[model samples]
Target: MKNLMFFFATALLTITLTFAISPPASADVPPPPVNQVLGLFDATIDFTGADIDREFCQQCHVGSQVERHHALVTPTFGCFECHTLTDGTFAEFRECTFCHQTSPHHTTAEAQARHCSACHGSLVADYDDGHYIPSYATSSFTPLTGGVEPDPTNHPGEYAGGCKACHMEDIGQGIASNATTHHGIGITECSWCHDVEAEATLSIRKCEDCHDVNSLHNIQADSDNDGVITPGTETGGYGHIGANADCYGCHVQSFLAFMSTTAAEPTIPSITSLSATVLTAGQAANLTIAGESFMNTSGGETFTPVVEITKGDNVVILYPLPAFTSKELITPVPATLEPGNYELRVKKDAVVSNKMTLTVAADVQVSAANLTEETIVITGSNFGNQPGETTLGNTLGTVQSWSDQKVVVLMPEAVEGQTVTLVTAAGAVDNTEITAAKATAAVKEKIKGRANKGSIKTKSTK
Candidate 1:
């Protein structure tokens, strides 16, 4: 009885000591349970004997003091609630301090202040308050429970209340009930099962031990440290501090997608870059890709870039899916381009990137005919710069012509009437024949039609 009284006195003193030193910040540690400070143990250097206040214990604990031959009358919370022996011959246990004495936690708030700073660096001034305590109790130390009690606004359920309310399994049935175990609410440690094999049986771990997570499956940050990615942040059961861990944290598959995939050595053609990130329509954008393989990936999968082009409000199928020019041109495909802003998406061994954009414009192409005044005028392609160019082709006979984007030329003298042919830098030739112009007026009409085609006009100095 005397020892019991002294222990309660110490329990009360522990509360005082905890409050007397310094209380941690609201953000530092979670609040201990309200009843965690329940009555002092009927102290013993070893706790295996009888509970002193047997009568008082019966009041609200809701269980039995003496368990009979084959059954316990109720659930357990305190020690005696589990029953020592049939005849009251109890097995003693050391006080909680004997074993739990080694404090493996933040000894002081100052030491803990750093770990929280990584994300909360913006709230330096609010870190103003702190308190230290040998144990949590009222004394020379002030309370750092944030307020008089656990702050309701700070989400008590997340910290303490959740422990009790979530243990619904404890109230099993009649007197044969079991103290509620935290079934699956994740209030228990996660590393306990985060990496568990699909066939591993679930281990019932203690609730307070949940935060000790390790391994990638138990991880929470950037796998590649690249800043942004898929299935972000949370890596643990809930999207918690453990979730935002490194890339390997929750997604080993995604990490392996990059780390394990082998990029093929020069198999096709190589590009230097991935091209632009954004573009305008018909802008004639050039893609900047480099490497030897027409296609390659972190993995040895064959792949290519599929390009589609569009211009201000006018999107067109300028390029289609990855189509190889030939087996030698496998994977990476270079587009025979037109004019417009383009979007490129790559699929290298099934790993595709978001669409990248670029610009393209073919403004040099334009039309014209010969004037009766002995001057030959030609159009088609972008010409204006060298207007003094000599007219090499004639409208009178079968005229053959080649054009730079700037201008077209009529070869000197052929026949009185002839059809026309055109050639481009890409080696494309067009001979959509037009009527021969025998008279000046007729030649002028042909010039007007070709001009409408907007082919740039030019004359040769020769």
Candidate 2:
């Protein structure tokens, strides 16, 4: 009984000393129930562990922070995936290099600035002056946030923003729940949004997301390096810069002038042969010229096919038939040509075809007319070396022989004073005062005298 009483007295003394050394509690209030205190602490901590839903994080991360996390994080990942928990609290991670070693963001500011051109080349090329960071004269300028208006001077080229200035701003503060931040609207990085096949295509529409119509036209970059600045169609290094608008829209007449100067000149037509190399003067003939690339009338409103014959400094223009083809064209020879050689050419637009030789012979002329017992001899220049029609008065005559300069024909029964006409392939000649009866009598007298002389000579020989 004495030992038990002493143990109780020591326990009582220890309890009294512990209470005396402890700090005083406020207002002597008793501690809350254990369950109530645990419940309050649980509300501040994420006890769901790895299976926790994203809604648990949304409660704390309200506006742009939530939007930025959703945009950059992969779908399969959650808030805890990139962050760490220490003493029941979550710590924020600012450096992407902590988890991603090869990430594009793992570089210095200068390196990041230089690498911007790889993806944003069109934006870099448009402005002649280099990109610059915006400067505010006073510290009173508040960054854009919930329900705040953007400054008018904050345009792209004015006192405007650079890449980080615009992209890093708090864009989701005033935006609707369904809306997205500026960086979330379109893909800034190729690898993040596009697959291999999509990257290979590199369509121009991707560039139109940030660059407006006028901005693309101002680029003036020879992207393909073909020496021609075909904005919308150019490909390769910079992708497609002009997807929303063409270069001509802003350049106007200057674009047209450039195209005119750089375009290929029209091909000149060639003249190989002509139908009638030699034509008679004072007569019209259908002439056919054969060559390549002869312009037809159906080419369009600007098609004007002109056929011309040039002699020395003189040029005679001829109209080509509408039915002409590229291979050949039929035109009429002008009767104004004198007896000389000329060059025939076809001109289409500013191109003149090769020259072909064309000769014009003098008109046929009658030299003489004579008559024999049964035939009439007609002599002329340019008889064409062929049989021709002959007539005395109203009687038709048959041609006995023909030559280029002379023709003989059997004369039918006709009066003494009659007109004789000779018609060759080239032209016709007429003699108004030639008489066949007088020439026939003269021929009969000459033949009789020759026969008498022949008879006298035979008698002397016997």
Candidate 3:
């Protein structure tokens, strides 16, 4: 009886081992093949083999899959992550629309039409001529499908095919469905009807048809995508179309007529000259800026004229002056500017005028050793090119000549070694050590030399 039990246990162990070593029932099936054109697996490549791994599938499929499939698949996602294997058969992976039905372009007809301006702005302008419906209705126009000619007698407005007769099927049902019903069709469905080569050729022809080759309208085309049409030599050397001509928005109008009637914007302010080009540093002076359009007379929120003084690339000082009439603006020079050669420019409403040189000179110096009775040369920087007052002690002296580096002044009746102050439009510079004794000593030395020469001549004569 014990021996029979031992034989039964051995038979049970053998059956259990056989089941564990055998492969799964579904392993016999093959995976779908990889579609080379679509770059996806489609019911042909074998996936049920034990040797097939996720890395094997990745070797063939790479990069972005968003254009084909909206969902992104990275290296981490295995083939089974998106595609499920149901009862040994791989689930079919369809196109992007299979999952995401309502994309941005398919949301509404208005949304699609609005997106067309990103590429086909010129086409949209041509369609606004109020002749799109008539153009499409003409019997001479060829339909997209061959052998079926358009019947002008059966013209239906915004019904049946409408714009879709020639345009692709992806352009929404008809023209009436979109927000731009009056504006006509856009190029949202361009890829459905034309290839890349055809699209390039059609774009050129569409722009040329309305604008014409070498015409003012064509030369001023916004082909550079700068949001404004740059005026070319054809338009009398006008720079920016926005500043030169007014189209009153983008409507069908005579370009020449608009250019003739529309007045160009006021010319940019220019700096012809400045009242004082050089001035003493840290002194307040009234500076005059001469230029055209210095004041903004056109009513509204008035723009205050500003003076910008810059040293190299850095802005040293900016003074905002009150509004004034005439072609000149008189403003106070700020006292904060240090001694340097700076560029002064006038700015109004963010437009900078021409630049002029302005020198902020260092402090003045008086030569106490070289003081003369008639003339005293005061050496200083930024002593402007005009004569000014010079005060010796309490007496005011006459300015003989003045320059950026030196000022010559006629001395007044005053004690020697007294404080002398030179005052100009730039401001005042005071020196306490200027002495009249230096002039007296110089005169005595000259007189003594002449007396000695006379005595020597008398001795020789005797």
Return the top candidate by TM-score. 3
Q: Per TM-score, what order, best first?
A: 3, 2, 1
Q: Per the 3 Å backbone cut-off, how many clashing residue pairs does candidate 3 have?
A: 10
Model 3 misplaced stretches (Cα beyond 4 Å): 1-267, 295-304, 370-447, 450-462
In what order do the candidates fall by lDDT, top score first? 2, 3, 1
User: By TM-score, how accurate is candidate 3?
Assistant: 0.29
Candidate 3, residue 181: Cα displacement in angstroms equals: 52
Question: Per-residue lDDT tens digits of candidate 2, residues 319-431?
Answer: 64433555556666656676555666776665555445566655656655655766667776766574545666445577788888888878644333345666554333335
Residue-level lDDT of model 1, residues 4-104, one tens digit each, is 10000011100011001111121111112211111111111212324423342222221221121111112233233322433324344223222334332
The digit string of per-residue lDDT tens for model 3 on 1-462 reads: 111100000111010110001111211001011001110111222334443443433233222232222112234533344455564344554433334333232245533544321222221222233322222332422211211223446753211112222211222211132223212332355532334565343332333232222221221212233322323211221111322222211111214443333322222344555656656566666666654444332212334456667665557434445333335566666666665566676655534454455666545554442346556666645555545456664455666777766777776343334456665433334454343334477654543443233211101000
Name the candidate, 1 or 2, with the larger lDDT value: 2
Per-candidate clashes, comma-separated: 95, 0, 10
Best by lDDT: 2
